[model samples]
Target chain A: MTDVTCFSADCNKSKLFWGLLALGGLVMLSTLSAYFYIEHHGHIVTGMNNQIVWGLPHVFAVFLIVAASGVLNVASIGSVFGKKIYKTRSPLSGLLALTILAGGLAVLVLDLGRSDRIIVAMTHYNFKSIFALNMIFYTGFFAIVGLYLLTLMDRKLKPWSHPVGFLAFLWRLALTTATGSIFGFLVARAGYNSALYAPMFIIYSFAYGLACFLVVQTAMYKWNNIQIDEYVLGRIKNLLAVFVAASLYFTAVLHLTNMYFAKQWDFERFILVEGDTYPMIFWLGQVIVGGIIPLLMIFSPGAAKSPARILIAALLVIVGGHAQMYVTIVGVQAFPLAIFPGYAETSSFFDGVVHPYSPSTLEVMLALGGMATTFLLTTVAVRILKFLPIDKLDQKH
Target chain B: MTASHKPERRDFLKTGAVVAGAAIAPGVLFYGIAQGRAPEEGASSLVRWGMLIDTGKCANGCTACVNACNTENGLSGKTGPQDSQWIRKLNIKHLQTGIEHNLPMLCQHCANPPCVDVCPTGASMKRADGIVLVDRHICIGCRYCMMACPYKARSFVHEPLADQNPDVPRGKGCVEACTFCVQRVDKDQQPACVEACNADGHQAMLFGDLRNPESAIAKAMLAYASVEVRGDLGLNTGVRYQGI
Candidate 1:
C-alpha cells in the first residue's frame, strides 16, 4: 500500500479556496438565521402568492437534486464499467454525491410551507401522486448511495461495491426522471404541461454533474499539490465538451418544438422572450453565458487544454444549468391561467392575477447557505476521513 | 464467504416461509376488521352530502354568501385575490360564442377527486359520508393536491396564520379548501353561506343529502338539469350548478 500525506500542509495558500470557504460559511449562517425567522414569522415572509405558490427555494432544490444525480456518474463509470481512470476517484465522487444530496434535501425541507409536518408526507403515503413517488425514490436513492459509499470505504466489503454502484446509477436516473415528470405530468399549467421535460432533465443531469465534478476535482488537485495527469485531464475535457454541446442541442430542440407546436405560444413566447427576468436569464445567462460560451471554450483547440479556461467553462456550465432550472420551474408559475375569461377580459393584466414573487432576503441567504454547507461538508470529508484516494491509480498502464 | 457454503437451500426455504407469513398477515387482519365493523344488512344510514346552486334564480349583485361565510367563519378580511376562497364568484364565458355567465364556485367534493388521486399523503381525502376535507394535522404540504384540483379550489396557507376561528380547524403547511362547513354539518345545520342565502330570501343555495330521495337537493336535481364544472374529468362532484 502506498503511503499518503496531507497536501493541505504545503498547498493551502490559494486565495480562492479561503474566499470560497468563508463565503460558503457566511451563506450557511445567513440561511440558518432565515430558516428560524420563517419559523417565527411564517411562510408569508417569502414571496409565494396563491397563483405563484412555488418560488426560488423550489428552483434551488430541483437544481441541487439534479446536480447530485449527475455527480454520481464518476462512480457509475468506475464501478459499473470498470474504468481504471475513474476507479481511483470513485470514493471522492461517491462522497460528493452524498454531500450534494444532503444540501438538496435541506433546501427542500426549508421550502415547505409547514416544515414541521414533513413526516406526515412520509408516514401517510399518497399512492396515486407522482410527487409522493418522488419522495420515496429520493429517500431510497440517498440510502443506496450512502451505503455504497460505505462499502467502498471498507476493503472487506469491496466485493459487493460494484453491484451497489450499478444499482445506485440506475436508481439515481429513475429518481431524476421522476422529478422531471412532476412538472411534465401537470396538464393544467401551460409552461409545465409537456412530455419532453423528463428526457430534458436526464440530459441536464449529465451536463451539470460533469461540470460540478470538474470544478471540485480541479480545486482538490490544486489544494493537495497533486498534479492531474495531462492525458486524464484531456479526456475529461473532451467528455465535458460533448456534454455541453448535447445540453445545448436538447435545449434548442425543446424551444423549437414548443414554437413549432404552437399550443402554448402565448405563454412560451412570454417566458422565452417577453416575460420579466426569464427572457434575460434564459437567453443570455443560461444559453450564452452558461451554454454557448462554455461550449466554445471547451471545444476550441487553443483553450480546451488550458486549466484556467477549463475551470471557467465548468463554472459557466454550472451557472447555466441552474439558470435552466429557475426558468423552467419559477418562470412557469409567473403567469396565471386565465380561468375566468369575462373577469380576465374586464380586469387589467395584473388584476385578479397574482404577480407576487420576489425571493426574500432570508430565502436567498438560505439557498446560498445550502451551497456553502455542501462545500464545507465535502472539504471536511476530504481532509478528515481521507475520502479521496491519493495514489490508487498507477501510471504503469 | 464461508456462511454461503453451508445449507444454502434449507436456510433459503426457512427464510422464505417466514417472509411469506409476514406478507399475508396484514391482509388477514384487514379482512377481520372489515367483517367486525360491517354495518347491519339492508340498514342504510349513510349520508351523501351535496350542494345545489341555482345560478338562474341567484341575484348576482348580492354578495350575501360571501358576507355570511366571512361573518360566520370570523374571516379577518385578509383574503386577497391570491388567497383561498371557500366560495368564489366566477364570471365565465364561452370560448367561441362569447356568452358570459356569473356563477359562484366552491369545492366540487368529487366522488373520484383528482386531488385525492394525486395526494401522496392521505391528507386530501373524502370522508365516508362524502365530505371532502383536508386533515391539516397530518398534511405534509407538498401541494400535489393543489395541482390536481381542476376547480383550483385548494390553497396553501403559506404563512403563519392569525385570527383563525378556534372551532374551525386552520394552520400552515397544509392545503385547504371548502369543508362544506363540516363544523355546522355535524350539528345538523346547513353551511353558514347556505343558511345566509336562505335567510336573505334568495334561497339560491340548497344543502342536503343527494342520496336521500326526499331531500330538497335530490328533488332539485330531479326537477332541473344541474351541471358540474369539468364533469368530463369524471369526478362525480357533489357541488352541482343549476342553469350553468
Candidate 2:
C-alpha cells in the first residue's frame, strides 16, 4: 500500500513540464502539416528550385548533426581521458548526443523529394559517390553511439565503457569528416573544393557541441537550485574559447586561400564584396557578431568570471554557426558556373545571373521543428532519468 | 516404301545449300542499315552516339531548335529560373579578343559524367551507347548531380507536370537533362533540334554514331579542327564544336 501511494505521487506532472511539452507538440504538428502540403503540391511552393536545391532545412539539419557528434566529447573526456568532473556528466552527454542526432536526421529525411521512396535509397549502392558513402557513415554512427551510451548508463556494463568510449570518439571524428567531405569533394565548384573542410568542420563541431552542452548544464543546475562548481566552469569556459578561436582561424584560411588563386579571384570577390546579402552574411553575421563579440565576452577582464556572460557568448557562437552555414551552402550556389572561361556568356537559362533564393514559411517551420524536437526530447529524458551531473565528484578522482 | 521415307545425300546437300543462301542473303544486304534496334532489343555498346556542331553555320537568331525541343518534350518553354531547358542557344563574346560567337549548347554527354559520379542512387547513369541520362524511376531528387554538373546542363522539376509528350517520360520531383533525345534516337530519328537545324537549311548540327567511320559527323570531326568546350577538365565530351 505504501509503494502504491508513492508510485502515484511520482506520476504527478508539473505545470512547466506540461507547458513545454505543449509548445513542442504544436510546432511538430505544424512541421508534419507542412511536409504533407509540400508532398501533395510539389517543391514549387518552396523557395528551392533548380538553382538552389537545398534550403533552410539543410542548414538546421547539418548544425544539429555536427553538434550531436561534438556533445560526446564530454563523455570522451570522462571515460577516455579519465577526467573526474566530466565523468559525472557523461550520462547527460551521451543522452544529448542520441536525442540531438535524432532531431537532425528527422529534418534531413523529411526534406527529401521522394520521402516515400527512401527504401530505394537504402537498396541502391553507388560506391564512388560521397553522398552514398555518407549514408553508411550516418547509420554506423547511430549503432556505435547507441552501444556506447548503453555501456555508460548501465552499472553492469560499466567495465566495457573505456573501449566503447574510445571507439565512439573515433567514430564521431569519422562521421564529421564524412559530413565535411560532402562539400569538399565537389570538384566543380569554387567554394567547396578544399582539403581543409574536414578539419574545419571537426573544429566547428567542437565549439558548437560544447556550447550546447554548457547551456543545458546551466539550465539543469538552475532548475534544481544548485550552485555549479567554479573550477569546472572556469576550465570549460577557457576550452570553449580555444574552440571558437580555432574555428575562426580555419574560416580565415579558407577565404585567404581562395583570394590567393588567380582564377578564384572573381569568385572570392563575389562572395566577399559584390554578391547581394552574401558579404553581409559573411562579415557581419559570421565574423563580427558570432566570432569577435563572443571572444571578447569570454576573455575580456572579468567578463569570463560571470556565468551569464559565458552563456551569452555560447548563444552568439551558435547564431554565428547558422550564419556560416548559410554563406557556405546558399552563397556558394548563387554564383554562376564558369562555362566559358575567357568569354562572356548569355542564355535564357539564367546562366550568368545570380540565382536568387528566399525561404518560405514552411521551410522555416520545418527547421524550427528540428530544434523543438531536441528540446522536447531533452526535457522529457531529464525528468524521467537521472541525467544531472553528480556532486562531490571532484574529491573522488 | 523405306526409300520414299528416307532422303538421299544429294537431296540433303541441295536442301542445305538453299537454307544457307536464304539465311545469309538478308544479313549481308542490311549489315549497317539495321543499326537501329527493334523495340525488344536493348541499347548496344557497339554504337557511341555523338554530335558535331559548326558554330559558323548556326544562325544568329534562330529559335527553331529550342522551340522544336519544347514541343517534342512537352516543356513549358518558359525562360524563368524554375523552367526546364533541355537545349539553349548561347551568345558569347571573348573577354580579351573582343570576338563574338553564337552557338547552341546542350548536354556534353561526357564519358566521365560528373552527374553519374555524384548520384547517391545509380539513377543518374550513362547508357551502353555512351548517352548520359537520368533514370527517373529511382531518383530521390537530392540534386547532388545538379551541384556537380560543370556545364549547367541539368534541371530539376519543381511543380507538378501535365500534358507530357507520349514518347517522353518526365514528371515533377526528378532531376532531368538533355538525353540527346534518346526517345527519337531509339526510333532511328534524329534529335528534334538537329532535324530543325537541317530543315532551316543551316545544317549546323550533325548527329551520328561516332564509332562508324563513314558517319558524316565522324568525317567532319576528322576534316575540321573541332574542340570540346572546357576541354581542360578532360571529360572527353561527345559533343564537339568547330569555328567557335
Off by over 4 Å in 1: A1-23, A252-263, A338-354, A389-397, B1-46, B81-83, B94-96, B222-226
* Model 2 TM-score relative to the real fold: 0.90
Model 1 clash tally, residue pairs: 3
TM-score of chain A taken by itself, candidate 2 = 0.94
Using TM-score as the measure, the top candidate is 2
Error of 1 at A348 (Å): 12
- In candidate 2 the C-alpha lDDT for residue B138 amounts to 89
Candidate 1: residue A344 lDDT (0-100): 39
Listed in order, the DockQ scores are: 0.24, 0.64
Candidate 2 iRMSD, 1 decimal? 1.1
Against the reference, the lDDT scores of all candidates come to 0.76, 0.86
C-alpha DockQ for predicted model 2:
0.64
- For model 1, the DockQ equals 0.24
Sliding window of 10 residues with minimal summed lDDT for model 1 chain A? A342-351
Best by lDDT: 2
